[model samples]
Target: MVNLSVATFGGGCFWCIEAVVQHLKGIEALKSGFSGGFIKNPPYREVCTGRTGHAEVIQVSFNPDIISYHDLILIFMTSHDPTTLNRQGGDKGTQYRSIILYHDDTQKEIAEQVFEEVTSLYEDPLVTELKPFEVFYNAEEDHQNYFNNNQDTPYCEIVIDPKIQKLKKMYADKLA
Candidate 1:
């Protein structure tokens, strides 16, 4: 079997993050899910209420040989507004918080290092939480590939399109 590594990131909506990362080289699978939450299996509506303590997150499975974890973490950090306490754009709530749920010690160390390197890129403090990976409750099927299917929708046009554009511009060499 081909060796692969997994990384979980939450920077606002999973849809936005997934849309950008899906195009990157070595991405084996990408899933929209809720992570860093208190519940075992959180539904979208419950997680949206913010009381579930879940943040909308994307779980990325990638080939480390092609795209290092460091690069993935750095890309994620730059793409989202990590300085915000609990929001991205107008999407507010604890569920919208920026976070990196590291899968192991190596991942955690790399994420922390990348976190420091990207801090100066922002004027405000990076509030992204770096925590151990626990569980990933997959979002409902309809939310799985929101951007690709709903590109004509306003949310995709206004929010996700720009993120896709930014990813293309910033990481041209990294795209698949």
Candidate 2:
């Protein structure tokens, strides 16, 4: 069996990122969480206040044999508005900022390369932050698998549906 590697990203709401990344072929698991924060074991409500310095992040465990880290980073950059700082859609706060928490020096290097390559795609300079990985506090159980459980909800329908459709169109070959 191929060893699984982990990647953590904060690009707005964890639910949105989780919904899109979970569909990728090599992904073994996806957990919505908080990272890059000063507080320890922060709750969802606390992070929502945007004072915790945490970004809503998704910790993804995937098999690199199927999907390279470079490809995953590329997908992530395309999936979110990296040009926007501290926000995605109507979600605005430090918690909604675009960030990649790299687990190692190699991941850090790769993230930089990917960012440089994709910078020209946007008219504005990409503001996506690349930081060394730190602790990840899993989001509350109620937030797990949020899109799948709350598909009919207005938020999911209005905010996440289009992202799913876009993922399907852009990465059809990578879907599980």
Candidate 3:
């Protein structure tokens, strides 16, 4: 309906990121997938090994009028640890690396500015990698909308649910 496009991000778990971004009002769709990785056509199993350069990411399509890039970037910065290089909480390795897959210079510029502002607040060098949008391979069907389907599951219970709660409490104003 809206002239929305995409913003792909990898903060650790795709499910968690998907949960948070999908709650945002402007986001039209959220596609849990793999990005910033080396393997071609990587699956969920392959990405878990930490060998693949890829990270669990969500491709977000959003309307700029409702949610500016700056706002989205802020949500992204708060949703995960940008200071952590190649990891987030218990998830470690390249598969968990923080990344922003920018489609154009505008996205890249906004991301860089946001990263700078965030990095200035924290002591560690923000390790979030800003990569050009290449290709996004959809994750397994089981992985899509995982938080909603698998909330009772251990990984979701232990990892994603809290993230969902956090997003809901912290960013309720942005919710759809």
Candidate 4:
């Protein structure tokens, strides 16, 4: 069996990130969750208030042999705007901040390098925080697979559909 690696990212709403990344090849599983927070087991309502210090993140499990972590990070950076601080589109506050939670020293180093490389592509500095992986509170059941379940919703059509299209166009070779 192939060994799977985990990468956690908070680029915006977990729904949007989860929807896009789950389509990539080698991704074994994806969970919508809250992380980098101070509270224990923060619920969606608390997280939405932005007081829990938790960012809506998705923990992605993937096989490195098929899709390297570097590739995943590149796709993530492109899928969302990393230059915006604590925000993605209409989502605002700390709960929607752009962040990458590394699982180890190697991941940290790689994340730093990737951030630097991606930074030069934009006129504004990249604000995506590179932090150590901490507790991940699984978002409530209603939040999981949100995009797939609510694709017809107005929010999904306006905010998430474009992201999916962009992913397909940019990483056609990486799709599962």
Candidate 5:
């Protein structure tokens, strides 16, 4: 039997992160969601207001034997601008903040090490939040697999395409 581990993080828009990570191998399942919030079962509208205290996140289940959690963490750290505080590109608000919600102590430790390693990559101090995994509220059905289904959309082409290209260039070996 294959054992799957979960990783949850918010690097910007859940759509961007989901589009990039879905290309990687060993990813059993993925869901665009919100986490690190104050309220329970927060809807997309509420979270988007940034008053809910949640960030847009993606929850991933993968086989570590094929793709290590360390690599996942590294990909997340590099794929988005973790150096920016509560923003990615034109998207602004606390809901757009970069964050990593670790599922356990091991994931947290790996994230810390990865953060240290990636610290030199940026000129600014890394602002990616590292917190224990609490709850993930799945985003609306329309938001799931957004890039794949809405490739023709301008946002997908402009914002998400570059991320996918970078993932291809940087983690070509990790792609499925």
Candidate 6:
């Protein structure tokens, strides 16, 4: 049996992060979802209202032996602008906020350490929240693997494509 480590993160639109992280090695599973909220099983619409307190998140199950948590944290930090609070790019509000909902103590420590290391290199402190994992409500069927299915959509072309391209160039050696 293959051992896997799970890390859930909310950074703008899940499709952007999913498309890039999916290209990484050691990633066993990546599901777009919602978490870090007051409500349970929050619907996409509800989360978008920013009242249910949910953030769009991706629960990534990866193999630690193949890709270390430090590497994963770096990917998470670089993929989105952690300096922005409750937003990323054109996506605004809490649903699009940056958050790292860690699964356990080790993940928490790695996340904090990575944040510190990353902040030291940049002028802006990481605004990504380090929250405890409570529940992950899978996004609507249409939101799953969105870029793969809706590549021609305006959002995909204008937003996701550029992000994916940047990730490929930045993490070329780590791509699957």
Best by the TM-score measure: 5
- Alpha-carbon local distance difference test for all models: 0.94, 0.95, 0.86, 0.93, 0.95, 0.88
lDDT string, candidate 2, 3-64, tens digits: 99999998999899999998899999889999998999999999999999999999999999
- Candidate RMSDs in Å, in order, are 0.7, 0.7, 1.5, 0.7, 0.5, 1.1
**Once all C-alphas are superposed, what RMSD does model 1 give against the true structure?**
0.7
How many times do residue backbones clash in model 2? 0
Q: Rank order by lDDT, top first?
A: 5, 2, 1, 4, 6, 3
Worst 10 residues of 2 by lDDT: 1-10
| Residue range 1-176, candidate 6, lDDT tens digits | 99898889878988888887888999999999899889988888888899988889899999998888899889879878999998888889998999999888998999999987889766777789998998899999988888999999998899889878888888887888
Per-residue lDDT tens digits for candidate 1, residues 1-176, read 88999999999998999998998999999999999989989889999999999999999999999999999999999899999999999899999999999999999999889988988999999899999999999999999989999999999999999999999999999999
lDDT of 5 by residue, 1-176 (tens): 99899999998899999999999999999999999989999999999899999999999999999999999999989999999999999999999999999989999999999999999999999999999988999999999999999999999999999999999999999999
Residue 102 lDDT, candidate 3, scale 0-100: 93
lDDT per residue (tens digit) for residues 32-141 in model 3: 99988788999899989987788899898889999998889888988888899888899888888889999999999999888877777777888888889998999999
TM for candidate 5 is 0.99
Candidate 5 backbone overlaps, count: 0
Question: Candidate 4, overall lDDT?
Answer: 0.93
Candidate 4 global TM-score: 0.98
TM-score of each model, paired residue for residue: 0.98, 0.98, 0.92, 0.98, 0.99, 0.95
Q: Which pairs of residues collide in model 2?
A: none
**Per-residue lDDT of 1-176 in model 4, one digit per residue for the tens?**
78999999989899999999999999999999999989999889999999999999999999999999999999999899999999999999999999999999999888887887788789999999888998888998999999999999999999999999999998999998
Rate residue 76 of model 5 by lDDT: 88
Candidate 6, after superposition: displacement of residue 114 in Å? Answer: 0.8
* Highest lDDT against the true fold, candidate: 5
CA shift at 146, candidate 4, in angstroms? Answer: 0.9
With candidate 5 superimposed using the best TM-score fit, by how many Å does residue 67's alpha carbon deviate from the native? 0.5
